[model samples]
Target: MIIELESVFNTEGLKLPFDYELDLSAIQVSGYSPIAQPVRVSGKVENKAGIVNLTGNAQVIYTAPCDRCATEVSKEYNFPLEHTLVVALESGENDAFLEVPNLRLDLDELVEEDVNLALPSKYLCNEECKGLCMSCGKNLNEDQCNCKAPVDPRFAALLDLLDE
Candidate 1:
């Protein structure tokens, strides 16, 4: 969705509202598509005292397998989209503002970037997720495993002293 901001940029106090659904099902995160539903974006671009700003919210439901236990987990996320729109930059490079060359803003692209940054680096079923046991390959969260971890040779002397 390309939003033409010609009027908003020229006229002070002018506001351009936008609401749409963005399809990002093809996006891959950590080798899987977690976003099964369309992203809901609702916001407005307005010029306040000659400065144009875009503000909105992007809502999505992400469903993916947990990183540790591989259990499926569904989570809802809402990311606030806020950026200052500028026609041109005064310096060499600036990350604080978004430059619109022809006064056309790709709303979907901006929203997608915000969603990706808001997503967690690693998804887990729960905070205290006890992953599978390395020895027996059993889920430690469901039940305790009988396999005893191998003791290092350096720690063997400490174990013998405790037994005596």
Candidate 2:
């Protein structure tokens, strides 16, 4: 969705409201397409004392595999979107503002970027997730495996002394 911000840029105290669903099912994160539904973005672009600002929230529920055990996990994510809209900037190094060069802002791009940045790098099924047992490839969360922990070869002679 391209939002025309020319009117809001010119008039102080003017507000433009926007609400839309953006489909992001094709976006892959951490080797999985976690987004199961369209992201709901709703917010307003307003001019406050000659400064245009965009404020809104993006929400969605995504399901993906757990980082450790590969178990499917579903999570809801809500991201707050806030940015200063600028027609032009004196310096190009500022990332704090969104530039609307042609008086049009791409709402989908902004929301997608924000949501992607806010997502967690690792997803866990639970805080106490035991993950998978390395030797048997069994999920420890579901069942404990009979594999013993590997002993270091340097400590083998010391272990023999205990047996004697």
Candidate 3:
């Protein structure tokens, strides 16, 4: 969603309130496509002293895989976006509000950035997650595996050192 800044640039100390909804369902994560629900954004843009400041709140629903177990997880996320756009003034244009050339703001990119940044680095279905067994590829949380594992000979020196 590209908001036109022409009107804001024309008037000094102008404040415009707007509400918009955007669909951002095509964002990819972990080699899978996760559908991002429609996000509602409402904010005010104010032009003060040749600078445009935008402050808004965005609400989004995201569905993705759990980091630990690769299970699907769905949740709603809310992010607040605020930024300022500075307009470059031309020579001898003090009274005249300088026009911002091709001022376009991408709502999708902004939402994606916020959502990705907000996501936790590690996600598990439960806090006490007993991960899969390394030997037989069994889920340790559900059941234990009985496969005998061989010890690496290189660790013998370290084991002896610890005993000392």
Candidate No. with top TM-score: 2
Tell me the tens digit of each residue's lDDT in model 3 across 41-133.
Answer: 778778888778777887776676665455577767677877665466667765324244576656557656766676656666667866565
List the RMSD of every prediction in angstroms.
6.1, 6.2, 7.8
Better of 1 and 2 by TM-score: 2
TM-score of candidate 2 against the unseen true structure = 0.86
* Collision pairs in model 2: none
Root-mean-square deviation of Cα positions for candidate 3 versus the true structure, in angstroms:
7.8
Worst 10 residues of 3 by lDDT: 92-101
- TM-score to true structure, per model: 0.85, 0.86, 0.63
Q: Which model, 1 or 2, shows the larger lDDT?
A: 1
lDDT of 1 by residue, 1-164 (tens): 99999999999999999999999898898789999899899999999999999999999989999877888989988899999999998787577699998999999889888898888998899999987776577877899888897445468778889999
Shift of residue 3 alpha carbon in model 2, Å: 0.7
Ranking by lDDT: 1, 2, 3
Error of 2 at 105 (Å): 0.6
Per-residue error at 63 for model 2, in Å? 1.0
Clashes of 3: 0
